[model samples]
Target: EAKEYAIYIGKMGKVGLMILLVTITSVVCQKSRDWHVGVDTVNPSGTVVHGHANIPLHRGDDGNLNANVHGSRVFGGPYNREQTVGGGLQYEHNSGLHGGLDATNMRGYGTRYSATVGGSRRLGPGTFSIDGGASRLPGSSRTEGNVWATYSVP
Candidate 1:
């Protein structure tokens, strides 16, 4: 019947429209992701060498998530034979928000843990921002925290 054919056509049209919308959304919301690596020698003799790498877990149009690991060693200095290893996760959002959590361990000293969060927003004719962080060292019973704020106009 003509009524049955018209119903089928209407269903097909909706399916096609959904497919087109999905395609457009995929193209517009593409993500950016990459890996980064670096090495640095502080002195000419290369007594201190630091190496680091950053890997992207999720990088999208509105935010980014990354994991980073780093290590440093003193080859031939007063801190010779000393080394440190650290790793952390960093997140940033297009909505003026960011945060990080990290842990580091030194050869002689114990491990240190830290976390930080910050955000910024447009207030009046300028931008207001505030950042706060807390850290704790190994064998310490107390945690230390600090906070800072700023307002800027362009």
Candidate 2:
């Protein structure tokens, strides 16, 4: 019957659309996973083509993970380009303590790596936090840490 045919077609269309969406998303993710993109095209073309994304692929009670990619073309064209791709993972304990590490590599630069460990505790009227870590850049390295306390006034 015509009615039956229409219903079948509708279901097929829905499935096709879903497949297309998922495929596009996966392709985009894969491309960005290895390239970082950036763009600033504010001109007569009215096309500001810039791409930078941070995708959180997993998360659970104990921790979460993310993927980051950044790329940028020349101001008006594609002659000059740059990209950076990396990811980060972090975990938190029930006691309000956490730690994480991040790493990335750029097109022309060497690998950059960093690690951090921090803890936060809630006090009577404020919250206190301490974080310490080190970073290794292309040609140098540095250590950094911070302690912060925050309170709100009524």
Which candidate's lDDT is highest? Answer: 1
Clashing pairs in 2: 36-70, 36-71, 37-70, 37-71, 37-72, 38-71, 38-72
Write model 1 residue lDDT over 24-85, tens digit each, in one string: 43443345223222333455443444555566788799999988776665544356557788
Model 1 TM-score is: 0.63
**Pairs of residues clashing in candidate 1:** none
Where is model 1 more than 4 Å wrong at Cα? 1-46, 122-128, 150-154
lDDT of 2 by residue, 1-154 (tens): 2223323444354344334434544567764443333224445432222344557666677665555543322222343334455666666665767777887776578778888777877776766677777778866666554544444433
lDDT for residue 119 in candidate 2, whole number 0-100 = 80
Give each model's whole-structure lDDT. 0.69, 0.54
> Which ranges in model 2 have alpha carbons more than 4 Å from their true place?
1-79, 124-126, 141-154
Provide the RMSD of all predictions against the true structure, rounded to 1 decimal. 19.8, 12.0
Kindly give the number of clashing pairs for every candidate: 0, 7
